[model samples]
Target: MTSIPNVTLNNGIEMPQLGFGVFQVPDDETTAAVATALEAGYRSIDTAAIYGNERGVGRAIAESGIARDELFVTTKLWNEDQGHDATLAAFDASLDKLGLDYVDLYLIHWPAPARDRYLDTWRAFEKILGEGRVRAIGVSNFQVAHLERLMENTGVTPAVNQVELHPGLQQEELRAFHERHGIATEAWSPLAQGAVLGDQAVADLAARYGVSPAQVVLRWHLQIGNIVIPKSVTPERVRQNLDVFGFELTDEDLRSLAALDRGLRTGPDPDTFN
Candidate 1:
């Protein structure tokens, strides 16, 4: 099994850079997929309360026979649960569903700027962090503006910012901002949901490296230092995704992949997502 490297968050919490994600994964299939991922040596598992598969993810963790301290589990607070009291309640509910005393990381699922309640929601996150119920706190789908507002208002910087990132959506400016602020950049939909797999540049690199196109793209993410979670229920693909540790992309290859960026997003825009 390949060992995945860990990225230290702003809070000094270590998180596996190459992990598993259960986004659109159905609850019924999540357990088996997560179990396979665990067996494949993926120590990080990212899910959200809205995904409705926390129970299944928890079940897999329980049955994996791995020690609780050895695995990193992450879940999010849903948009509906976007107030101080409601966010606290939602955290308890998510913990109950995951069957864990605490999650390794918790995130505000989105800024929901239109709602204008994320600042209040973040206060709850700070409280939870202070209570030691979560190892780290973060935000997903948050733009630089949202981050700036949160920092200015609450005086707390998120440990990580999980966003829609891939070869097609490089997010250069946002990533530079994160680097300056010490916030880790995590990529969801890292492969562009298979859209980048067939690109001629990606295909050519895969051939050069003797790996799958998916692996090529994932390797690029690793080289770029983005925490990437590529999801696939198939056991073989699950293993394949983590097999990126062996190859290194050259500067020329990196340049080629950089050219593939077209400012595309596989999900909603954070500034407008309500």
Candidate 2:
């Protein structure tokens, strides 16, 4: 098994820079997917309450017989559960469903800025950490404005901000802001939902490196110092995604992909939605 590198969080927790994500993966399919990822040597698992597959993830980990400490399990608090107390209540529910004593990471699923609840939601995360029920806390789909609001209101910066980052939607400004703070940037939809997998630039780079385009994409994220959790139900792709550690991208190659940024965001804009 190839070892994926780790990045230390501001809080002094060590996190794997790459992991497996289970978004839109149904409950029935999650077990096999997670099991395959585990068998493929992935140590981290990212899931969510909204994903409705936490039970399957917990079952896979329990059956895999890997020590809980050896595995990094992460889940999130949904929009409806966004206040301090409600978020805490939601954590109990997620834990009940996940069948675990604790989670390695817990995040506020979205800022829900319109609802104005993330401030309290982050407080709940702080509580979770104080209780040692969660090792680290973060946010997802949060932009710079949302992060600034969170920091100003709560005085706690997230350990990671998982967002939609592909070549098309580089989110360079937001990433720079994350770097300015102690927060680590994590890439969701790291393949741009396969949007860039067929691009000529990625294809040429893949050919040059003797790797798949997906590996090139993952490599780009790692080279930029972003944590990535690429999702795949296929076992071969599951194994292939983690096989990105052997190769590296050059500065020129990195600049070329950076040029492909069209400011195209595939997911809904959190600001407009809320």
Candidate 3:
């Protein structure tokens, strides 16, 4: 099995730097997809309640015979489940669906600033963490202001911040803040949902490295210190995505990719998405 490097979160828990994501994958297909990833040496699996595939993910984990401690499982609370009580209840539902007693990490799927319940929801997350039901807690798609308010009003800082980040939409400012605050930056659409694969710079890097464009992009994410979860239902692609630890990009190559950032966002705006 390939050894995936671990990124220590703000709370001191180690998470695989690269993981498999089940974003759009249907519930029925998710099991096979997750199984393929596990067989390909992936120890981390990212899913969400909104994805409606937690059961499939749990099935794969149960059947894999992989030790629970050897695997990292992550799930999220959806937008509708944003209040303290609702968040706790929703988390129970997620655990039930996942067939696991504890999750490695749990996240608030979005800020949903209009609802203004994330602070309350995070308090519940703290409660969950206190109960030792989760190893770490985080928020996804949170902007700088959201993070600022969260830290100001809350007692615990988020361990990770998962967001839609790709070379095309390199979240430099947000990432910098994460570094300053000891938060791990986890990228969801690390490849821009295939939007950045065709970029000339990425293609050139792939050619130079004798690898695929996806590998080049994934490698960029790792080199730049982003915990990236790339989703693919195809067996070959799933294995190929995890085969990104072999090469290192030089400073010039890194700069080339950096210049490709156009602030392109493939998802909803965090501040206004509520």
- What's the TM-score of each model vs. the native? 0.99, 0.98, 0.99
Rank by lDDT, descending?
3, 1, 2
* lDDT, candidate 1, 211-254, per-residue tens: 99999999999999999999999999999998998889999999
Best model number under lDDT: 3
> Candidate 3: RMSD over Cα atoms?
0.6
lDDT of 3 by residue, 148-196 (tens): 9999999999999999999999889999999999999999999898999
Per-model CA lDDT versus the true structure: 0.94, 0.91, 0.96
Pairs with backbone N, CA or C atoms under 3 Å apart (clashes), candidate 2: none
Question: Which ranking of candidates, highest TM-score first?
Answer: 3, 1, 2
Colliding pairs, model 1: none
The C-alpha stretches of model 2 lying farther than 4 A from their native spots are none
Error of 1 at 46 (Å): 0.5
lDDT of 2 by residue, 1-274 (tens): 7798888987998899999999999999899999999999999999999999999998898889888888888898889889889998999999998899999889888888889988878887898899999989999999888888889878567999999998988888998898889899998999989998898999999999999999999999999999999999999999999999888899999998998898777788888665
TM-score attained by model 1? 0.99
Window of ten residues with lowest summed lDDT in model 3:
265-274
Off by over 4 Å in 1: none
Give the TM-score comparing model 3 with the true structure, all chains together.
Answer: 0.99
